[model samples]
Target: MSVKHDWYQSEAKVVITVLLRNAAEKHYAVEISGQRVHMTADDYELDLLLLHPIVPERSSHKAYSTKVEITLAKETGVRWEALEKPAAAAAAAAPPKAQAKNWDKLVSEEEKVEEKEAKGEAALNNLFKKIYSSSSPEVQKAMNKSFSESGGTVLSTNWGEVSKEKVTVKPPEGTEFREWDK
Candidate 1:
């Protein structure tokens, strides 16, 4: 199900034979590092979809059975080559320090922006609490009643309201009849 090999550059040829469970095998001629290698299947299970269905009566009578054969084409020329000298040297060289500096600056700016946003949110919350507390006692009572009935908590000091659930629901269907029965 999986293939693993050592690091190979662009041109590599390897021949591998995999033994399968169903007595079916596959041969692969792979090009590894510009070399062509031939691999033959060693007792590999054949894919059911690729295999012909066996007729039990005919098979019993026959001395030999038919098998499916698959051939894969190989690249004639050099499939892989080593990287050019100049490009390889440049890639091996150390990267510029400016990239790291820019990344650090970006991170610092993001943190500052997040801090400002959090401060603004706290200020807005405080303003809301002050306004809610300064309102008339009747308004405060009404707000508290609404908050409690809707599964919310109204803080005493700040008069800030926090609700457990955001959504409101309407009475269920046939509630009038149910109420009458009760």
Candidate 2:
């Protein structure tokens, strides 16, 4: 059989339940430290280091048919934000040891110039889109259809650098159109 344990906290205390199937009642032992809870069931031991302080004197436990329930009194009524300290946060909190800097991995002057040029191009493209969207509805619809049909790579010839041209409208001419004309 394997030993399993779970823990939860209430307004006043933290309760830990250990599942020990087919184990004798006298075979379990529970202990508490200033900020830790330890339990032994059959041959298995569980150690839980609490994030907050607890009152060992006020802590109690009860053994049931196949489980042991331990209640640890909270030193303060305030709820604990977490049960255990996060290992990643602890590692990040520590100041890194100073090391020699590597100049080879740094960004080159040419790359900086290219990055600035890319930003300027992006800003100009945004301005062009704003101007196109604020144009007349006919122009917007023609541009939308042109862009959709050509995957936006084919530019609209109606609008040029210094002049705005009108879109040519053509009626559909086919057998299906003649039948629908009725």
In order, candidate lDDTs are 0.33, 0.64
Stretches off by above 4 angstroms in model 2 are 22-26, 88-182
Worst 10 residues of 2 by lDDT: 94-103
Count backbone overlaps in model 1.
Answer: 13
| Top candidate, metric lDDT | 2
**With candidate 1 superimposed using the best TM-score fit, by how many Å does residue 95's alpha carbon deviate from the native?**
73
Estimate, for each residue in 17-38, the C-alpha lDDT of model 1 and write its tens digit.
Answer: 2222222324432222222112
Task: Put down candidate 2 lDDT per residue, 1-182, tens digits, no spaces.
Answer: 23566667998998877777644654877788777676676667666667788999999988888788889899999787665444464344333211222334454555456555766767667555766868887667666665555444444635342134433333345422132357
Candidate 2 clashes between residue pairs 3 or more apart in a chain or in different chains: none
Q: What is the lDDT of residue 27 in candidate 2?
A: 80
